[model samples]
Target: MNPALANRPGQHLRIAALLCTLLLSLLGAGARAELQLLDGIAAIVNDDVVMLSELRAETEMIYQQLLRTQNQAPPRDALAGQVLERLILDKLQLAIAQRAGAQISESELDQAVAQVAEGQGLSVEQLFAQAAADGLSRDWVRDKIRNEVIIGRVQQSIVNRRITISDQEIDNFLNTNSSELLNAEELQIGHLMLPLSSGTDEQTIAATREKAEALREQILQGADFRQLAVLHSSGQNALQGGDLGWRAANQLPTAFAIALRDLEPGQVTAPIRTDA
Candidate 1:
């Protein structure tokens, strides 16, 4: 406490009066702004409307993030449009997920936050401190994390339903090209996969890419790939150290086949994006 405040007998009264004044000022400002944001719609998505408040919040968040990470921001108008469009997509998907009864509980959001913290080698407190430094409130971060989770659920639910194929479809495909499929050369491949899920931010994608490149360099330097994969890979065979044995040329996906086509038996390629 200040020495003057400590010495003064009515210091408590002074502090309380100052707080009351500040609260009143804040309330007055909020009351003025609240009406416009509460009533104004930014975009309409079917039965739901995106409020001006939401657009402003998302734009502010992304604008701050870009300023911090890039040391500069694009023109505000362009950035606001981009951010608003993203918010609209999120609102649409989240509405669908809600209709499908998908929700992220508080515990789940907490766990996701913790996992993100762990991935960055930080504790929860440190993570929040960094987020504060980035001008992100804890609540805002939690909401973003929740949106990501729910969107993943919605996309998975919709895409799986849309793309499901019957056994007869598989049989027909096989029968259509039997000779070429039967005679195609097969490669015995062992590898890792790192999935970059939908709606991930550029910063995260860049960090992940750097990690993958570093691991690639280590593998080239004779570091044990299997152990490294087991430790860091998110691939389905991560527990088996990324061993996907004896895949046929016809069966190998285009990206992998192209990346690995020229490699020798013991060689590993750089990070490949199957989705891309």
Candidate 2:
């Protein structure tokens, strides 16, 4: 300490006052709140950010499906957070694929797209048109498809490296598990949904069926199915224009799967009763 300043009590008080003033200035400046008006990120992976709106969008569809399936679900916020974990996992898988140099060639991707289109009974252009109607561009769909393929490759590689089995073990496992492992098909589906409320009389149910028939006709006549879904579907996912996305074949209700099996992709089922 400088002897001159140390001897002066006034100097000590002045120094303490200066420190207090500086602390107050910082606090006051930091206290100002900036309002955010638009969407922002829900979570950040190493090289990717999952947007808040994206999480909400994904969860809303799942939430609707749960209700339609007669299953209890958590609150929207809880569902979104849970779904965010899945997004993070996908991001991690993608990063692993990138590190491994897993690649999907353009021709291979093109063929995959064609297969999906053909399976749906749509031309490639029609598939792109449907994707556009749902706010996804062809490039975006391609990129997503590419990422899925890469992740599958990387995961298969990881599994191959981790698992070990002798011929005897393989034979025993196959003998034990073969009967349990019945083959099942998966279906990627979309719906233009309408609900049938309970306690409705037979007359009302018939009327609802008639309405559904009319809409189905319009769809067959080339009216946009998504537009009709937005206008008439009672589903919470009506806002998404009634996309059911994808589900495993066994995941679908048995009756619905049977009905869906005969209908080509992009074809609307007659307004089936919600109770059905």
RMSD of 2: 14.2
Which lDDT values do the candidates have, in the order given? 0.77, 0.71
After superposing candidate 1 on the true structure, give the runs of residues whose Cα lies further than 4 Å from its correct spot: 1-39, 68-72, 119-121, 165-276
Please list the residue runs of candidate 2 whose C-alpha ends up more than 4 Å from where it truly belongs after superposition: 1-39, 53-79, 119-121, 170-276
Q: Clashing residue pairs, candidate 2?
A: none
Best by lDDT: 1
Where does the lowest 10-residue lDDT sum fall in candidate 1?
A: 65-74
lDDT of 2 by residue, 137-192 (tens): 78866776677677778879987997787999788766765434445566666576
Clashing pairs in 1: none
Model 2 accuracy (lDDT, Cα): 0.71
Query: Mind giving the per-residue lDDT tens digits that candidate 1 earns over 41-121?
Result: 899988888887777776676566555534555555655665666667778898888888898878998999898779668
lDDT of 1 at 64: 66
User: Residue 24 error for model 1, in Å?
Assistant: 26
